[model samples]
Target: MFYQFPEDFYWGGASSALQTEGSDSSRGKTIFDVFYNLAPNRFFDGVGPNKLADFYHRYKEDISLYKAVGHNSHRTSISWARLIPDGDGDVDQEAVVYYHEVIDEFKRQGVTLIMNLMHFDMPAALQAKGGFENREVVDAYVRYAKICFELFGDKVKLWATFNEPIVTPEGGYLYDFHYPNVVDFKRAVQVSYNMIIAHAAAVKVFHQVVDGGEICTILNITPIYPRSDNPKDVAAARIADLIFVRSFLDPVLLGQWNAELVEFLGEHDLLPVGLPEDKQLIAANRVDFIGLNYYQPRRVKAKEHVPHPESVLLPESFFDYYEMQGRRMNTSRGWEIYPKAIYDMLMTIKNEYGNVKCYIAENGMGIQQEDQFRGADGVIDDTYRIAFYKEHLRYVHQAISEGVNCFGYHIWTPIDNWSMINAYKNRYGVIEFNPQTGERKLKRSGSWFKELVDANGFDD
Candidate 1:
């Protein structure tokens, strides 16, 4: 490989609480159940999150697989329901034992654990009480964060407060893709603000309590590209970027929200409600780094047709999404394949957000292939996935060379894990698992990744 990453460069894989852990009910209810039960058709194949990868039982075996694949670091989330059954009151003893064992086993295997405190798994018990929109939910989240820091702070050095906190407001509240499906911009802004406060509160507690741990927030940043060279389209792209990417990154990293976003919210009368001290909390608890999960770019243009003047207004009412023509796309998930977006995102973080230390925390393609382990060879020739990883990684190398504070690369998952709605609908794993029988098999890409790690680069 021409672009050799730095020595001691971390290479790993990432998974979430609701996606891989199968013991959803072993502790308590979560927002996943609320969404699925409300609208089963929204999920791919109509499968819920109950039957995840069963990592709760098979994690010991899974960590060994991580070693086989040359992963020195592994990222996984702790389930809130598992820790506090109702997301507030008492810590579950069973969950504490299981997670401690998992962390210790990883240490025994010489792998570093990057633990995320929450990953969209709001205990359904809390959602029934208004979820993040309610102030009490923020207090519950702070308590949960405190418990994790106190319990696992010694072993876990890298702590992520929340994984894609903005997605709840964007996908769940404003777009109706998740539970408590309400399409209200005002409510979305309120939820987004609350999540930021919750994150700050968690970070404050982590710093106050956890002595030697570092904390960061994960954002699934989709770089926005203008449809054409038209200046109006360019302005629209900037607005979209301000709304989607900078909305959270600015506050978390720069210690304040973007002025453009604040002004836009003011124009719409959707400015978030915050206590006077909330600003002080956010400003005080700035993160040490950022975890950028870039998969694709968002193509945008100015809205061409204005809605009826008398109609009810929404965010979409002002902007129209204009997908760029002839852009590369991921075939299975139908997501636009824009590897360059990763480089652009890093550049933006460097230029606009003060060049904070960050990493490609989650990036991978989801493939729908059934014959991944169909032969006596027990090997999957996942050439497409290999290509996806290499192309995206090339961009990371380019960004690193250009002075982006890029640290490491963690693919979306290590093994084929289950998703909340789709339930193993797509595969983005280096290691392919027979979800039916719990058989672990390394795909050809897994071997390729191991060589990449061993050689410190891909040789041409």
Candidate 2:
């Protein structure tokens, strides 16, 4: 092996319950279901989150695929709607049994199970009263977290409170890309603050209940860069980083919000009113580790003009997105392919933060029109995906060698599953899923990943 990892380094892939598991009818409705039902046209191909990859009925087969891929650890989330149905009500006994069976099967296969409490799938009942904007919803979420720790904490050692906590506010509140789409900057800030508090509450409960279990939250960290060395551009990038990256990162890791962020929010009159004990809870319950989902870097320049007084306020109002000329891009998914960003992110966490333990929670390429790559043997020859992983892993390996405390690397997913809004437009999985026939086939990247995991690394 050209670059070997530590003996116990985790090698696996990730999935979310709402994206993979089907049987939506049995599970209670989520805010996503309500949103899709209200506006099915908003989704690509008019496909909502119904009967996704059917992981609910096919988890045993999926676990077999994980074993075949040489995965020692797997990251997935539990569906709150499936588990508790109404979000704050009696537990669904069937859902509990199913999760236990799934955990036991992973243990039998020698795969470490990493379970997440939430992944952008809040129950519809909770969202009816303003989702995270309502303090009652925060208490409901804490209750759900407690139930999870009590029920399955023994089987799952690694638990994440949430996945990409920023997405909830950004997509739903600001961008109108998710459920209960509301375009309000103040609500966005409130949602962000409430989520941080909820995460702290979950961490506190995890510590109180789960013995010998580690708790963390997953963040999609994208280092922002200025278009030039100009001070204004640099400042724009800095502010963007504060809003997107450090807003949640600082609070979860350091147990306090960033000073600059607080000042900025206060200046704009967007600061959320903290609960009496919110500060103390956040200060007391910090995470044991972090899970970084890095894909691209954000390049920004100073805004060309000031926004009108009546214009909607946003972090982007102070900065303009700049696309670097001649940079490589994944045209299929319309995202920049910057492998070094992972190295930069890991280094930032090490230097700026306290060098906390971390892992590559979700990182992979999503390609459209993948069927064209199928060869005569009927196998998808996704060599581009292989190259993508190799490039990113090289940077990840560099960071690990530099003492970044990054212990694991998991791809975005093990199988192609349904994505929100985009539906099944882009596929980011080692195993190809045939939606027409419900069959699974290992792509070339799957075979390559198996080899990479088995050897711990690959030769140049």
lDDT of 1: 0.86
The candidate scoring highest on lDDT is 2
CA lDDT of each prediction against the hidden true structure: 0.86, 0.92
lDDT of 2 at 36: 88
Model 1 alpha-carbon drift over 4 Å, by segment = 309-312, 370-376
**Total clashing pairs in model 1:** 4
Candidate 2 pairs with clashing backbones: none
List clash counts for every candidate, in order.
4, 0
For each candidate in turn, the TM-score is 0.96, 0.99
For candidate 2, lDDT tens digit of each residue in 126-188?
999889999899999999999999999877889999999999999999998998889898999
